[model samples]
Target: MGRIAVIGAGMGSLATAARLAVQGHRVAVFERAETYGGAVGAFRRDGFAFDTGPALLHLPAVYRDLFVKTGKRPLEECVELVQVDPASRHLFPDGTDLALPNASRAGVISALDAAFGAGVGERWGDFLGRARVVWERTRRPLLEDTLREDTAPLGRDPYPALKRGLLRRAPATVAAVGERELRHPGLTALLSECVLSYGLDPRQAPPSAAVLPYMEQTFGSWYVRGGLRALADAVYERCEERGVEFRFGAEVTGVVEEDGRATGVELADGTRQEADVVVRGAPGEPLPGDLGRFVVLLALRGARPADAAHRTVVHGTDAPHDGSPDGPAPTVRVLRPDDDRLVPDAGHEAAVLSVTVPPQGAVDWRAPGYADAFADRVVAVAGAAIPGLAERLLWREVRTPADTERETGAPGGAVPAPALAGADGAWLRTANRGVPRGLYLVGGSAHPGGGLAHAGMSGAMVADLVAGGPGGSR
Candidate 1:
């Protein structure tokens, strides 16, 4: 069996290592961080815990499949998985609040009808129906299978919108589709904000991106009993059980390529470890694309109301955040999990408020009081989601893009765009198989692309390529 050198201890990287080890290969994971999880990290203060990265899980079947394949215990046996019922609550500029039901299309339509009016729900439902078409079309080739070198076939969208004349001229982007189909401004915001949550600009995102909302709405959003970070820990533990080694605080400086084939990795300390397969799990190539989030973890003084929504998005009003009076208002996502594990006690609540901001190149996240000032503005917007938020606040901690860069090693804290159909393949991530034979890319920056489920799919594809399993490499 070949020795595998995985670059980071992230979810995808760990998933790859565990699966490869189960296939009878030797795997060792090296991570620069002190812990296993790369971005799936947690923060604690005064006994209150908050997820520093993704707080919710969508499409947990990816991990469930991983557990079933790698060991006897299923995912639920490893980590207590619970479905968040309300999925999300949306707040609009017109003071309309809609609590969307998880995996319940009829219920969602009803909620939208009750809030937005009679036909608005029907319009959104129709849009979702189209989005489902997008999902079914691309789910297999773009996600389940590995990307081939030709890549031309993948660029041709399976959206079936243009030739079919779904619209006047086949809307160029998500926003365009939303504008044409969801004529209501509020509906446009809902569709746009859903894309924005993925760090994509609805104005530029391909219509194929609709698969994101489709996947979530169909599969439903979930949470672990502890936190999303627990999922990563479970994968790491599974790796250990399979005899996959982990080296913390070990950073890879470069891949040792010989004659167009990866042979080993060089550590930051000038040490070289030979391996037959080298996987790039961490982000090294800095692509200056997509906006990221500004997170504020609030430890509040009151218990979460029984009826309070789990996730609430305050749609960006026509406002700005760069101290300029003009740009569109940044979308804010507030997550207040009902799990008692997150709060200090039954008397208090722990919540996270995240705002999508322009990338570091576009916005100064480190200007004097930039993060703090921006955090204050985010809190103000979040108040729309959490009533009487100002009074409930006990203390708040802010996380900036700089913090992201420091933690995840993504240059300028730039987030990666999820794999989409159009953009002339510009949005296509690097293939799971790297240019050099034996070197592979497996993570958010790689094929399939970001979000927990996509990352898992990327790992599965990479493992398949390594094991000569289904969808073997070219």
Candidate 2:
């Protein structure tokens, strides 16, 4: 058995470590932070808890398969997964409110029709049908397997464009698809927000970006019994169960190279840990113009309403739909999970409001009053969903891109979007291989790219390549 050194204790690296340990390899994980879960973190104060990262999980099978392969205990046994019914409620600028049921196409269609008048549902449904085609065409190449050496075919757009008139002009970007197909302002805004939520500019994102909504609507949204942090805890525990060693507060300064191949990692303390292979879980340089999340955690005085939807999206009137950065406000997503663990007591509630904005370099998140001013706008908008929000809010905590940078070591705290197959692979992430022999990239910045599920897939691909010996499948 060979020795493997993992650079970070993020989900992707933890998943890779567990799988490699089960495969009889000696694995050790080094994390710069004192705790695990790079971006998937939790905040606690005065008996209240909140997830600082992703609010929901989609395509849970990716992690389920990991747990099954690494141990006898499956993922469901590790943590309680609850499906979020009425998956999300959307409040459009035109005063249109709609609640979409979880994983039910018919229900979503009916909801759309009821909110936007007749025929709107069919149009949106038809668009998703086309999106499924994109999903089927790229799922294996993009998610299930390692990225190929020649990614030309995967670079081409797979969303079949409709034939308008005698000429068939394929929509290049997601915005074009919305303009030509959905046609309605509300529907277009909905599609734009879906892509924007992933930190991608919908105006420039490829049509294949549609796969995001397709995946969410198909697999449904889920929440862990505690928070997404619990899912991270479960994965970390599984790693420990597999005998994987972990060194917290151990920062990797560089990848040790010998004879043109990575041999191990050099630590911040000027020591080196040698191994047969090195896996880098830290994300690559943030993409130019990429976005980061601005979040506000609310401590409310009242109990969560029984009828409250787990998630709500309040679309902004000044959203940067055209890729301009000067918009007064961007779309905001409000999360109000019913889990009691998030609140201090039965009489109180916890809610998180998040919005996508330019990363740190583009905007100085540390500037006085910048974050709170933005938070005020967000709270005002979220008030549309949460009745008497101002009166209910007991206190608020704001987190910005600067905070994310300090926590994750990502420059500008720019979040990476999942790789898409279009615009000549402009959206594709770096390959898991080709970094250097004996070196592999596993995390949001590589292969299938970002998101909870895609990161897990990256781990699986790396493990597969390591097991296949030198010059493994690419």
Candidate 3:
């Protein structure tokens, strides 16, 4: 057994620490903040709670594998998965409303076909099949390996695996992939939605990411009962039970290296913790990856329109008055598909509303009067869905790109990492690794791009590398 220290207690760090500890290695984690979860963290105010990051959860299989590695089952006991219905409703300018399901391939296809005209379903299916192939081919090479040995050493290329007929040809961007599969512009819009969910533009994202929408629509979007944070907390709890120690409020400043090998981490306070292995879960340098900014406003009381479909619903005063006939009234609407807005302001209840903006650079995001102007624009866009959504004036909040970077160390506050669009950018992302012999890199920034499942698998792959050497187990 070896002593190991994991930097940052996000999902990736937790996964690594858990696996190492279960392997009988002594593991300790240092978190800059008082809590874990990094971007997946949560906060509360006035008896209401909100998830600060990763509001939508998908690919429970990744969490399942982590639990299994720790000698436990994830679903039956740890966290109960709540399947989302009508995953989200897409509101189009042409007055067409499409409801997407979490795991109903037919439902998604049918909805698109019904709204967009004939033959769209089959095309969508074919596009999804291509995505599935890519998933199979890349899952192991990218998700299950570090993709690099250490910093300054870029490791092996995973392209040969895809070239072996296991995956499809990857386009430079999601738009390119969708354009190749379907001729309809709406179909392209549907595919671009996947890019938005990952905080990227289809024109700038990797074609490999085209599989994400299929994953969400086929596997079903899910949420933990207490919110997504429960997943992080559960992982942390399991780690503790298995003898992992966590040091909160320890902001890591630098990686301690010897002979070009990572040996430990130096905290912001100058405390150096040594270990047989080290994992970096936070970004050290800023990059033009995925960026996200959100404003969350909560209502202290009263139920509102929720469920998977809420993500795309166009909020409006005329929103379907689907209030509960038997309990507290509830109504929610999606005002603008591109930006977040509420539909109606009329109601004698409390509610929480969230508005998300596209990913952009720090300086561009902070240009004078951007926040106020953006908020006003959202209100205007939502005016159609909710007649008085802007007037509801209960509470309001905003998160700038800089704030997101400060909070999560996410390069330029990007979420789900940037797609491996260009060969150069892809190589740059894949180049860094552990500086010391025993250390490694395993997170969204490492390989297979970002996503909960991919990052978790990255950690497991690193453990496998240590156990079986760089060649990996046969």
Candidate 4:
């Protein structure tokens, strides 16, 4: 059995450790932080808890496969998985409210039609139909298989350009598709918001971005009982069960290499842990930051409404892209879980408010009074859905990219954008294999890019690479 060293006890690293352990490889995980779940972390204060990273999970089958392949117990046995029905409630700038049902195409169609017009549903359904082609064409090469050095095939947009009567071609960018197909301003914003949520610019993102909404609306959005961190905890426990050892507060300074082949990791303490393979779960260099979120945790005075949707998205206005806080009202996501575990008691509610903004390097996210101003703008935007939200705020907690950087160790507190298929496939992430003979990359910054599900895919690719060689069995 080969000895494997995994850097960062993140979801991807943990998945790699667990899978390798099950395959008879000895795995040890090293985490710089005291806890696991790199970007997927939880924060608690004053008896209330909030998920500081991703608040929901889409395409859960990735984790489900990891659990089933590694142990007798399934994912459901590890965490209480609840499908967030009405996956999201969207409030458009025009006062349009749409509660899109989870995983039910028909239900979503009806919801859009009811909220907008009869044919609006048909148009969106048609767009989804087109997006399905993109997902099918790109899913295997971009997600399932190991990313190749010449990923130009995956980079070229697979979204089919529809022939509209006299026109021979369809739209190019995601924003163009919204304008041409969706027609209505509110509907266009709905589609754009999907890409924006991923830290992608809808204006520049390819039409393949349709896959973002398609994947979520098709597979469904879910939440663990306590929080996403609970799922991480379960994965960590599963790794422990499989004899994968972990050392918290173990900061890896650099890769210990022999003739360009990674042999192990050099820790901050000057001690070295040797292994046959090294899986890097942490992010690489920062690109001029994409979309970073400003989070506000609100402890409300009353319980969350029984019929409340788990997520709500407020679309922003098309303001100029000047480098200022008041440039444009950023898109906002508000999550309120029905589970009482997040709050202090049954009488109160804990809600998380997140607004997508430019990365810290692009903006002075930590300037004096910047936090309060951004928080007020976010609260103002979200107030459309939650009446008297400003008053209902018993207390609030704000977290920005600086907080993210402090937690994940990624430079500039930059959050990695999910890999996209466009810009000459510029969005394609680094390959899993061929870094060196023994070095490999895992987690959101690697192949298939970041996001809960995409990171799991990266782990699967890396595990396969090490277990079966570069051309390993997947």
Candidate 5:
């Protein structure tokens, strides 16, 4: 068995390390942070806990498979996974409220119909039918296997275009699909927010973006009992069980390349660790269109409402689809999990509000009062979801992209979106192999891209390639 060195203790790297250790390879993980989980961070104060990263898990089977493959214990035994019913509640700009049932097509259709009037549900259902086709066509190359060198075929748009009178103009972007098919402003806004939440601008996202909603609606949303931080803890524990070594606060400076292959990594402290293979799990610098999340964590004095939906999205009026710095008030997502662990007691509640915003490069998140001013706007908007929000607010903690940069080491605090097929593969991430011999890329910045599920898949693919021997570099 060869020695393997994994850089960064992000979800992908942790998954890769455990799998590699099980395969009889000597694996070690080096992380710059004092702890693991990278962007999947947590904050605790006065007995209240909050997940600072992703609020929900979609396609949880990815992690389930990871646990099953790496050890005898399954994911359920490691962490409690609660399926969120009434998947999400949406409040549109026109005061239209719609609650989508979890993983139930018929129920979602009926709900959409009841809120948006008759026939609107059918339109969305039909759109999802097309999205399902996209999912089937790209599932293997995009998620199930390593990214191929020639991704030209995957680059082409796969969403079938509607025939319009003698001329069939295929929709190039996600916005085009919404305008040409869904037609209703509310439906369009819903679709836009779905893409925007992933940090992709709906206006420029590929039609393959349709698969996002399909994946969510089909697999359903899940939450860990404590917070997403608990999921990270489970993965880290699994890595330890597999005999993987971990060195925290070890910053990798550069890959040590010799004879056209990665021998190991050089650390910031002037130490060099040699290994047979090097896996880079750190995210690359933020791209031009990359975006960051601004979160407002509210500690309320009263208990969570009995009728509160686990997730609520309040759509903004101006530039709802655009995630640029100059865009209008951003659409905000409010999360109020029913888990008691998040609150100090039944009398107190924790609510988190998040929105997509320009990365640190586009705007200075640290400029005095910038975070508070933006947070004020977000809280004012969230009042629509929480009854008597101002009166109930006990204290609020604001987190900006600047904080993300400091915590996660992602430049500009920008988050990477999942890979999409279309627009000539503009959205596809870097391949897992072929960059350099003995080196593999895993994480949100690499193949299959971001999201908890995609990160797990990237780890699996990287492990498979490593097991294939040196030729795997091809």
Candidate 6:
């Protein structure tokens, strides 16, 4: 059996390690954090628990396949899947509230018809159909192909199948795509919300990403019984069964290369571990693209205004039993409120809000009193959306572009790898296989893009390549 050292014990790393161990390779996984699941983490304060990353599960088949291939029962048996009914509620300015049911294409169409008009649903169907095509055509090539082998230089460029399918026909901007598919402003705006959640804008986003909402609906958005972090723990459990070893609190400092090939890693703790292969599964900086907006997060103590959705507000409640101001604003505002009666603590109220600002260079927001400053900014830009939002806060926390960059290890805090808007942005994405041999990338960095499923697929594909297994380059 070959020896392998997998870096980072996030979902991607665990998946890679498990697959490699099942292949009879002696695999060891090193994680920088004290725990597994980089962003897929849970924190318990008092009686309430909060998931730090990934609230819903999309395309659960990806996880199920990983388990079945690794000699385990399907993921459904491992983790209880709860389909969120009404999927989600979208609030609009015109006092229109739309609840999207799980995979309810008809409902969504009907809602569009009621809100926009009769012809809108038909047009929506056409757009959704095209988006489904994008999913069908790109899923295997991008998500399932081993990045190392599939990306190996094939004399000339490969991935033409993926390139032609969604990348070419899609315009370079989210606005562009929306204009083409949607005639009504309201429907288009709703679609843009999806783009934002996926960390992109619909107009400039790669046509490939049009599949996101569809996948969520078709596969059905699921929540773990306890929390989203359970999914990470589930993957970790399977890895352990497969004999994958993990070292937490072991931060990777650098990749070690010799003779023009990756062979090992240097840890922040002053230790070097060698391996037959390595896969980078961490989030990465963004590729310069068409997105003109940047995000700032503000932590608050109360519920955001109901109409905050249209006025640049994203609400995450870490607290409860409180309220914030409401008004019109141009920037995105997020309100995360702490409710002690419902939540665990009385003194601990955590409210997270986000805003859209002009694209700027990275700046640090972790400095002293950064949270208060961020709250001030939120009130300033989205003040009309939340009147008197600032004075109501018990405490404030801010995550600036600089803070995200430093905290997430993403250059310029460019997580979600910038939006894959337009054909040019799509092509600019880095392939899994690097210029140097033996070096491969998984996680949110490589092709097919970010999100848990995409990262897991990247790791699995790279592992397949290392094992010379089926599903590598054909």
Of candidate 5, the 10-residue stretch with the lowest lDDT total is 317-326
Model 2 has an lDDT value of: 0.87
Q: Residue-pair clashes per candidate, as listed?
A: 0, 0, 25, 2, 0, 39
Better of 1 and 2 by lDDT: 2
Q: Which stretches of candidate 4 lie over 4 Å from their true place?
A: 163-170, 287-289, 318-325, 469-474
Please provide, for model 4 over 1-474, each residue's C-alpha lDDT reduced to its tens digit, 9 standing for 90 to 100. 999999998888998889889989999999999989888999898889999889899888999999999999999999999999889999887778889988999998899889998888888999899999988988887788887767768767888756465766756788888887778887788887778778777777788888998898888889999999999999999999999999999999999889889999999999999999998987787444256767888888877778877899877853212235657777778888988899899888888888766666677767888878778888888887676787778988888877788888877666777777866776777777745689888887887887998888888889988877552224
Q: Candidate 5: which stretches are off by over 4 Å?
A: 165-167, 317-327, 469-474
Model 4's alpha-carbon lDDT is 0.82
lDDT tens digits by residue: candidate 2, 1-474: 999999999888998999899999999999999999889999998888999998899989999999989899999999999999989999987788899999998999999989998999999999999999999999888988888889999889999877565677888788889889998988898888888889888878888999999999999999998999999999999999999999999999999888988899999999999999999998678666468988999999989999999999988852432213455555779999999989879999999998887788788889888777778878887899899999999899999889999999878888888989988878888888755698999888888888899888899899988898432212
RMSD of 4: 2.0
TM-score of each: 0.95, 0.96, 0.81, 0.95, 0.96, 0.76
In model 6, the number of clashes is 39
* CA-only RMSD, every prediction: 2.3, 2.2, 8.1, 2.0, 2.3, 6.9
**Ranking by lDDT, best first?**
5, 2, 4, 1, 3, 6
lDDT, candidate 6, at 211 = 64
Q: Across residues 1-474, which tens digit of lDDT does each residue of candidate 1 receive?
A: 999999998888988998899999999899998998777899999999999888888878888889999999999889998888899988887778778999998998898889878988898888888888888777777778887778776676555453235445676777777777778887788777778788787777788878788888888999898888888889988999999998999999999999989999999999999999998899755444566777899999988998888899888752223533345566789998889988878999998988766656577787878788767778888888777989999999998767888888977776776788776776788888886899988888888788788788888899998877664322
Error of 3 at 345 (Å): 18
lDDT for model 3: 0.61
Over 235-260, each residue of candidate 3 has an lDDT whose tens digit, in order, gives: 88989989999889888898888887
User: Alpha carbon lDDT of residue 122, candidate 1?
Assistant: 91
The local distance difference test score of each candidate is 0.82, 0.87, 0.61, 0.82, 0.88, 0.59
Report how far residue 101 has shifted in candidate 5, in Å. 0.3
